[model samples]
Target: MAVDVLNESNWAVEPRVFSDLGLWVMDQMKISTDCDLTIIFNEPDAMEELHLRWMNLEGPTDVMSFPMDELRPGDGTTDVEGMLGDIVLCPAVAATQAQSAGHSTIEELMLLTIHGCLHLLGFDHSDKDQEKEMFGIQRQLLLTYLAARPGELNEVIPLEISGE
Candidate 1:
């Protein structure tokens, strides 16, 4: 997977970690190595504009996904490869949610990163059953990702989505 991270936020972000997280998600989804993914950390203003234009929402959201190829996870084939799309994240907004959720800003960003990638891969929580399946896979992937990096575990807790 070709993963690129563009940080345009005021806060300092570990771009490599975001790249690794994106790649790991692709691996877990069995996407081909030829696929491309980009993660963008933007200021709240930029995010708000995007939210208004694309989603027609009024404010900055935590994360937004723009999928290019409409790839779905675990189709069990890598015969096709293309741009997976961009995950635009607003750290400024995530910080507020992190405080409420009792986790570090980085942890919240990580969770949002995974959540955004899942969306790019055609995962959604449009209904109760979809929420269960998506959040279950999300939590499992996050836990495994955290467990694999014990040192980074200090930087992140086991994230618990409120409704999951």
Candidate 2:
């Protein structure tokens, strides 16, 4: 899997963490090694513009996904491959949400990354059942990712991934 994280925001960003999360999400979903995904971090002003333009929402949201190729999760027998879409993130907004959610900004960002990946893989939460299924998968993905990492809880680092 090819994962790239571009920081287009004013905040200092760790490109590896986001890239690592993307690779993890791809592997967990049984996506092919040839798949590519991009995650971009943006400022709230830019994010607000995107939110209004793309989603038609009024304010900046924590995350938004634009899926291309419409890739879906695959069975282990045959992994799916495509140019998975982009995940746009707002760190300033994530910080505020993290404060309310009682976690660090990085944790919130990581969760949003997984959520965005799910969206890229065609997961939706429009209804109650859909919400349950999607969110359950999200929680499971987070936990499994956490469990696989080799670090202290406070200093969790994303896995390092290179080309297969």
Candidate with best lDDT: 2
How does model 2 fare in lDDT? 0.85
What is the TM-score of candidate 1?
0.89
Q: Write the per-residue lDDT of candidate 1 for residues 37-147, one digit (tens) a residue.
A: 999988889999999999999989999999999987766665346789999999889989999999888888888999998999889999999999989988888889998
Candidate 2 versus the native: TM-score? 0.90
lDDT of each: 0.85, 0.85
What does the lDDT come to for candidate 1?
0.85
Consecutive 10-residue window with the lowest summed lDDT within model 1: 155-164
Off by over 4 Å in 2: 152-164
Worst 10 residues of 2 by lDDT: 155-164
lDDT of 2 by residue, 1-164 (tens): 39888888877667877788798889889997568899999988999999999989998999999999999999888889889989999988988888899987888888999999999999999999999999999989888887888552356442222231
